[model samples]
Target: MASGTSVSPNANRTRSGNTLLVWSLLVVAANLRPALTGVGPLLDRVQAELALTPAVAGLLTTLPLVAFAVVSPVVPRLAARWGPERLLGGALVVLAVGVAVRWVPAAIALFGGTVLIGAGIAVGNVLLPSLIKRDFPTRVGLLTSAYAAVMGGVAAVASGVAVPISRAVPGGWHTALGCWIVLALTAIVLWLPQLRTPRPRSEAVHTRRLPWGSALAWAVTAFMGLQSLGFYVVVTWLPQVFRDSGVTAGDAGWLLFLFQAVAVATGLVMPTMLRRARDQRAVAMLSSAVSLVGYLGLVAAPGWALLWSVVLGLGGGACLVLALAFLSLRAEDAIAAGALSAMAQSIGYLVAAAGPVAFGLLHTVSSGWQAPIMLMCVAAAGQVVVATVAGRGTVRPTRP
Candidate 1:
């Protein structure tokens, strides 16, 4: 995180003019998760009203990961063609349309709109890091952490309010889901000025490509995927796990809300911690260790659910922010950063996409939560192992 170390060519470009652009980036970050998380709180109402089978209902969560994997690789190329700011603006436009389209009371529109929303988010996911690298390279650590907090905080709010918005809006779950269009629109409006600012030209400088053949790169990729998988597993199953332990559905829901709330704090703090550390191994190990304790605690004593949730949230949130930082930290320039983001996220999301389904299947096969819960513990340990290898300060020499 030292600006003097591996300075991206544009690292010197950070200045006061970025204040509005920074806020705009945060606004866009705010919209990225609401469309995804809002659906989870309202899923039961949606499934019953739409007469959806359990299998189909699951796609409501999985579609975003699918879109992320399918669209992420293409996003950098698209950004290369149309400036990142313009592409981000266009993606927000698509997100707005997608969020609004869900208002159409039909199953096709529900799934289709989710796909569109996911696709837009996928593009934003890849481009945002590169955008940060170009516009705020010197402040990468702070800006990344801040926007990450914005994204998590908005997601928590959306999840908490989705059901209430449904009741208040008259259209029930449909309106609840559609209400997020306001967030998307807010992003689009803020992002408009960025579109007018020309994308910086760094195309002429050819940095080495992403070090894909390096073991460290694969380690980083595994760390990203495992952390994502652990998070999605908790999000999809934690409430049910609590209910099985005799907690009421309402309180179980509150646990989910609490989880996200704690996550917002870690999202804001982890990058700053990473920036100050010489090597990230200790932070990485500590995060996974916290998650490990939480997983084991949930299995052994779900009665203390709130306590375990806060621990899991802290660890999971830290892991995610650090994974994001790896993309920026590992690469030397904007193009390399984009390539690394695309590589890590594309593979990472696909690995994560399997979490919910696999957990559900494991529960069904065992007729108990024990097996799936233990698998999560294994994943938490794996995170520590991979982070150790990936968190090394120096990248390996590029393969010929």
Candidate 2:
């Protein structure tokens, strides 16, 4: 009776601790995309208010990707030295500050805060997989889907509400964008307990280098980059695309909302699909093909925008879940997962950083959306090709 009492208390404590960690992680995931995604619905207003050209306005989206590309490679080492919990906590501070600074009445503040926001998100992006691999090795697929769905759901909400929020609030778009800081602050509070936990010995003792020489690693990196490019391009430009096609700004925002809402649904279902599949290749190819067809449809008939958004959402959501799942699934352990994630995201985001700028430039130069939509079609085709290699059952070697 005494032993049972002792064990039960300890077990209860463990269970409660784990529950807190899971909620904290989900809150962190919720913060990753809202500040950035909120910008998409308000891009036209920002452009008109600032008297900016489309190409320069594209930079508003590209800047964060650049920051992600630049900062991601160093996160594993930072997490190793500071502990992932401490580093993640610090990142939330940066994200909160960035969101606040972005609300300041200066153009420089807008761009500069975006960089900080990107840097903050980059750390969370690279470390979450490692944390999951370390803490939930048996539940990687389910947890990945869970967080990915949270990301999509919150992102969709941010897009859908930005225009409405801006109108309702005093500061217009800036306030709409800045309101996400509340979430960042909430996440900080939820994550504080993690800072008190001690780092695991393995994480403290060794740091892993990225697997730059492995073909499989490269394949994963390409897959990550291409999928990100597609997602970011849609997030950055879809509202504008709809507006140009005669949709009202309000309706366009709702359309972007619809796109991400579908993505959230797809992300939630991905784990079941992944569980039944032999490997991820077929799923990857089929999703990519669906996205291609959607992009082609957008090019062929802008009137069918709603249909294409749903199609693109299905493909984008599946691809995102797979890309994140591959980070842990292909790695041998947590350390390897951290390294591979850093490698894939650093290079991957760099590739994605070019997408919005290029798309906008094409739109500006050609005076048509077809050319840019076609460019996305090419990217989707590339995703199909890369998915074949990245989706293999082969594990990424621990070291190059």
TM-score: which candidate is best?
2
Local error of candidate 1 at residue 43 (angstroms) = 2.5
Consecutive 10-residue window with the lowest summed lDDT within model 2: 1-10
For every model shown, what is its TM-score relative to the native structure?
0.90, 0.95
- Model 2 TM-score on a 0 to 1 scale: 0.95
For model 1, how does the per-residue alpha-carbon lDDT over 1-400 read when each residue is reduced to its tens digit?
A: 1221223324433565467777888898898888877766566677688897544666777888888888987776677666677888889988988898888889999989999999999888887887787667787788888888888888888777776677788888888888888888888887786666555355432333445676777777888889888876776677778877887656666677778889989888776687789978889888988899999998898789889989998998888788877777776666767877887888888988888777777877888888989989998988888888877654443411
lDDT of 2 at 14: 83
How much lDDT does each candidate structure score?
0.78, 0.89
Q: What is the C-alpha RMSD of each candidate to the true structure, in Å?
A: 3.5, 4.6
Separate clash counts for every candidate:
0, 0
lDDT of model number 2: 0.89
Model 2 alpha-carbon drift over 4 Å, by segment: 1-13, 199-204, 398-400
